[model samples]
Target: MSGAANPALLLGASLSAMAAALHLAIIVGGAPWYRCFGAGEGMAKLAQAGHWWPALLTLGIAFVLLVAAAYALGAGGWSAALRGLPGLRWVLLGITAVYLLRGLAPWPAMLLQPELRQPFWIWSTLICAGYGGVHALGLAQAWSRL
Candidate 1:
């Protein structure tokens, strides 16, 4: 309640969270479906049945929640209100860092997994890094405001 909250921090967090969610949704959900239904009758049936719908929904929900959480943590007086919770901010920052590393790191193991194309992995990694940098910068600004 007493601490100041930076608007830029919240916006950055929100955008980062959204990007992460999108990456997860496509990579995680699409891979499995593609693996299970690789150009066959089963694949055709699954596609016709729209099994991917749930995955898309999940991504949408995650995006909303992440954005809301960012607003809560960084927008208006919420950040100030929760400023009493010192560890929370650090934990969020840690989560952001972890996501960045996971998204960006080049795991040799992935090369063996034919289901995931190397090009796709590289692109996703880059996107994650970008998102992480934005969020990190935002967090720093927010901390300073506090």
Candidate 2:
């Protein structure tokens, strides 16, 4: 990797890390948080009942976000060891795609289930788009090194 730091990737990493933290916080905040975060009433009820599934599911998402953050840090030249990870390019591409696709999730959902639309969908879509854009720019900037 180059000696220069990639600002885009750094921001992307921060965003991902923040998202992971939010997921953890939601788990700690219980049923109300789950409902407020648009995880659905079912998830909120499960959380209220102290079922393992809600926390487990949220934890899995948090872990993935953390992994994505690590990859962004590595790709941004902030971590030498992570930069050397096998299939880094492919993994980064996959991450970027996932974020972008999630950003577009509202479009299909709006068409298929307009009744389910909420403010969370709009805000989350924008956030995901911003994250995806940053990752895309960072990946492009560091393509040759990877």
Candidate 3:
């Protein structure tokens, strides 16, 4: 069973890995690290008070993203188990759609808030859209092979 080499899976894996690392830092670095990410004073207070639910939630998301990336790669034939999974192509499609949706979802917020027009927000949104586009292309390539 061969499929086109899906670069999107690799991209997702790399991004997810970085996000997981950041999540780990957010979980352990406490108030100072959290503050650097523009989490606001309330979160800083929560971190200082040893309440890490918010970070935990982010960490959960980061972990799931990592898993999805791994699964994507595996389904691309990087692993036997992953290749054997049912509906691998459909799963890839879903992931692509999700990334695309997330990338576009910020547009409304950016339009409504002047602060979101800053370089940071623009760059982040660009990256998100780029990632989504890559994943979409990868999904199409892999599906063609299927």
TM-score for all models, in order of appearance: 0.51, 0.94, 0.80
All candidates' lDDT scores? 0.56, 0.92, 0.71
In candidate 2 the C-alpha lDDT for residue 3 amounts to: 69
Clashing pairs in 1: 1-80, 1-81
Candidate 2 clashes between residue pairs 3 or more apart in a chain or in different chains: none
Top candidate on lDDT is: 2
Model 3 quality (TM-score): 0.80
Per-residue lDDT of model 2, residues 73-135, tens digit only: 999998887888778888999999999998876777777898756788888988998899999
- Alpha carbon deviation, residue 94, candidate 3 (Å): 2.3
TM-score winner among the candidates? 2
How many clashes in each candidate?
Answer: 2, 0, 0
* Deviation from native of the Cα of residue 131 in model 1, angstroms: 0.9
Order of the predicted models by lDDT, top scorer first:
2, 3, 1
Model 2 weakest lDDT span, ten residues long: 109-118
C-alpha lDDT (0 to 100) for residue 140 of candidate 1: 67
Q: Which pairs in model 3 have colliding backbones?
A: none
lDDT of 3 by residue, 50-145 (tens): 886767776887787776676577655566666766677777677677778877888899999987886656666677677678767666666756
What overall lDDT, based on C-alpha atoms, would model 3 receive against the true structure? 0.71
